[model samples]
Target: MSYPAVPRRSAVANAIYGLFNPIPFGFFVAALIFDIIYAKTGTILWAKSAAWLITLGLIFAIIPRLVNLTQVWITSRRFSTGADHVDFWLNVVAIVAAILNAFVHSRDAYAIMPAGVWLSVLTVALIAIGHIIIAVRYSTDREYFHG
Candidate 1:
């Protein structure tokens, strides 16, 4: 069924969204780097930092992404059919993986990033690759949101 079109957000709202949109990519990179350091050095500090960054990234980027899907559908009044359709699910899976990963750090001196941590980082990377592909393949697609 068709949905009603929502009014466009104000300039301030758009500005705020612009601020939030690119956060996950940076956080994902930071988390991976932290995890790698922990894995290689067996440092609990790095492990705990990775866990905290992942949690923050999950809150700041992934959750807002889901909310953006609703915002776009509301403002545009229709679901996107091509790359955006696939992008949505990719993001969902990555976000869920990240949430699980955020809880995998140990509360001890030993660096303990469990399998879930790697899974989260990998899924987020996959999501990154997916967006890159979409950008390259559909550079002119009007409906595409550039992250």
Candidate 2:
């Protein structure tokens, strides 16, 4: 099972993807840090800050994810291996977890303690795994989409 050779993205699309793809990772990492700080200090400010960061991460993730969705599923007829699907689903699940974490953070500050931290951890882990998958696939596959 190999992906069909689709036309490469326009330079503008590549530029947009290159610019935005890693932004969410940074935001998510920051959110995780804030989550940890909130957990340790029991500060409402930290919890609120983390919620904002996660929201920002999701916002930043949109463009790259849309590009990925089109390239991996809509354009390609098949994946060379299962890793592509794993990477996509990992990202999707991470986004879902972050959304849930954001909702959890919307509650009263103290109420968000352990659950917020756990969700943040889970989201970060999933995103990290997704990125790792991409890195590994890119190293192995000559036709990897991201160039």
Candidate 3:
């Protein structure tokens, strides 16, 4: 079996990636806030707006991080390394939760708004924060976090 070569990234590139890493959470938080406002107002408009924001955030902001994960996975396919397992599952949960919330919001999903808010906060926000922390901690050029 052949492993794909992982290209070395410069510190500037890593820092840039680190900066971009949190943007999804930022938008996810915005969506959560918008959802809260919708819940408080009992209006579909805010919910719909939040859904779109989540969709956009997931597509543009979070997707790059997912791609980076793929790159890292190829570099180090070590899922059973407990930490790796947790991180992998968290990322999966985050994506699934975000997509689920967006779908529900767009289609008037019947779940409680607060429940959705909690899900976003727990899964999406937390996972993104984890990424931000890892990126910042391992921002050095020679080796990315897999060290």
Top model number, TM-score = 2
Per residue, candidate 2 scores C-alpha lDDT tens digits across 62-144 of 99888777767776526435776887789899899989988998999689888988998898899889889878877866656
- Each model's TM-score? 0.72, 0.84, 0.64
Deviation from native of the Cα of residue 36 in model 1, angstroms: 0.9
Q: What TM-score does model 3 achieve against the real structure?
A: 0.64
Of models 2 and 3, which has the larger TM-score?
A: 2
Candidates in order have lDDT scores of 0.67, 0.83, 0.65
Over 39-104, each residue of candidate 1 has an lDDT whose tens digit, in order, gives 778867787787788777877874557455765555543534456556666777887777667656
Candidate 1 regions exceeding 4 Å error are: 1-15, 77-79, 106-111, 114-117, 142-147
lDDT of 2 at 90: 92
For candidate 1, what's the RMSD?
5.8
> In candidate 2, which residue pairs get closer than 3 Å at backbone N, Cα or C atoms, i.e. clash?
none
Ranking by lDDT: 2, 1, 3
- Which candidate should be chosen as best, given lDDT against the real structure? 2
RMSD of every prediction: 5.8, 4.1, 6.7
